[model samples]
Target: MLFGASDSYSADEKMQITVAFTRFGKNLVQRMPRVRFGFVHVVNNDYRHWIMSAIGGSSHPTIISHGNRFRAPRNIAAKEVCKREYATEQEWKNWDWRSEGDLMLNGAIFTQSGDPKAAKKFGGYRMIAYKPAHMVPLLVRWSGTLECRPNKPC
Candidate 1:
């Protein structure tokens, strides 16, 4: 059996904490056992920035699983994309700034760190854009039974 959980975040506010959970049952097939994985799916441009910042700065085994579907309009100047798309400068200020695209997903094997505090130092909006008072935590949790009997499985 496969189990999963999901959550959403807002672009205007820093995501104080985000978590993902998964459960797995013993594999019935003789093929290689599947390991639990976590994914962070971002919808809007702002959400994408936050997620990317977290993944890029994290020391964990996180990686970009899928990229955005929309590419920047090459015909327009690079700086114009945000100004035209967003109504206010404030809305576009904290954005990823580098590229103009939407939709993103980052994946990592769920492994809890002994030091939860380590997350604070990781590269993310909490460190870059927000002040200490506005900081937040992004946590991913994975748990499940593995094919290895009586052995520790990740």
Candidate 2:
């Protein structure tokens, strides 16, 4: 995938995604997935780096972040884990964005909004099972770049 989110899309083309057991390491645009449109469920994972925020979004996307470990970057200003792109307070105030069971570290914060009943409604839906935050290191310890023995078949 490219470093940034781009392209034109229609309402029907929106996606519903589940991000689980993923190792989100150094990258740009907050070093994590930037939700554009549709439903997204981000489950247990290791977040190690970011420039702006961890999980960004726009266009009134419904996002549910749960059980993820967010180790924010050293920059104090970049501690927030959720960033809304090009939207005003009144605009994004009602979008369905919620974070539960997430472990925020180093001042990381996730601003949730909309649908208090969302949890009461969607909380029972366990489409993807994830372990507790402490197990993330063991689950993704071997992830990231694979050193293919320089100049080898890699």
Candidate 3:
């Protein structure tokens, strides 16, 4: 989960938080290769709004779906799924992940692509096509949990 205040963050802070999250994601993926779906908790309204805005305004196509058991922002869930035809250096400049928004290590789920049905089972879950990248930065001033689940039938 991601936690932060409703207040705005400077660009530098955002960058730092992104780096931290990237590191955390990398470690988590290394330790748990089976991870396919992940959850981010936002505790602050301002930060939450920012995240929602960013995701909503993202250049990528995002799908707004219904929320199930998970407590998603605004009682709704969002996801962006796309295929990665080629790898770009700009996408992996600060990390080994495939894209800037990708949080997965190898850009594949369970060492390969994931099933869309499996991803849809989770509320607010993302089974992105390009591996999870360019996630909104988790503010250092906030607190939250990053929960991950294996690529199993949910």
Candidate 4:
């Protein structure tokens, strides 16, 4: 579940996305929703399972992650929750990717970079009222229209 452009990265695209009160898990190939060439606000989501990083992006996308839960997989090497594509550490270290009020579990780590005031710059209006990261499970308990019975047949 990726958002925005794939390779053609540019701020001129003016693409922006806000994901709130959702659940992200069971993804192995990529992040929950990697964005590119825009601003993305990922707030108040449950992340219980993921082989790769929970949130990832590239091409200088401004990622503002707040009040989300990230539970890393058993693999110790895959505990980091932020990944940059097609950029080296020196180049990606300047990207605006900030994580605030997020709950990390099972050695989950978020490599935040760029300016700390970036969130306040992009987050202008308060459209939705979301709970803290600890309450993500309760907020996103029942998503979709189907009965999601874990460890059992749906």
* Residues 8-98, model 3: lDDT tens digits: 3322222111112221221111111111122221111112211121221111111221110111223122212122222343431221112
Best by TM-score: 4
Q: Which 10 successive residues of model 4 have the least lDDT summed?
A: 122-131
Ranked by lDDT from best down, the candidates are: 4, 2, 1, 3
For residues 1-154, what per-residue lDDT tens digits would candidate 1 score against the true structure? 1112212222312222222222111221211111112222221211111211222211111112112222222222221111212124443232232221223223312212233333334446532222121111111122335468565763
Predictions: Cα RMSD each: 16.5, 3.7, 17.7, 4.9
Model 4: colliding residue pairs = none
TM-score of 3: 0.20
Quote model 2's TM-score. Answer: 0.80
- On TM-score, the stronger of 3 and 4 is 4
lDDT of each: 0.23, 0.75, 0.22, 0.80
lDDT of 3: 0.22
Could you give the candidate ranking by TM-score, starting with the highest?
Answer: 4, 2, 3, 1
Superposed model 2: Cα runs more than 4 Å off: 1-8, 12-14, 27-31, 119-126, 145-154
The runs of at least 3 residues in candidate 4 whose Cα sits more than 4 Å from the true structure, single-residue gaps closed, are 9-12, 126-129, 145-154
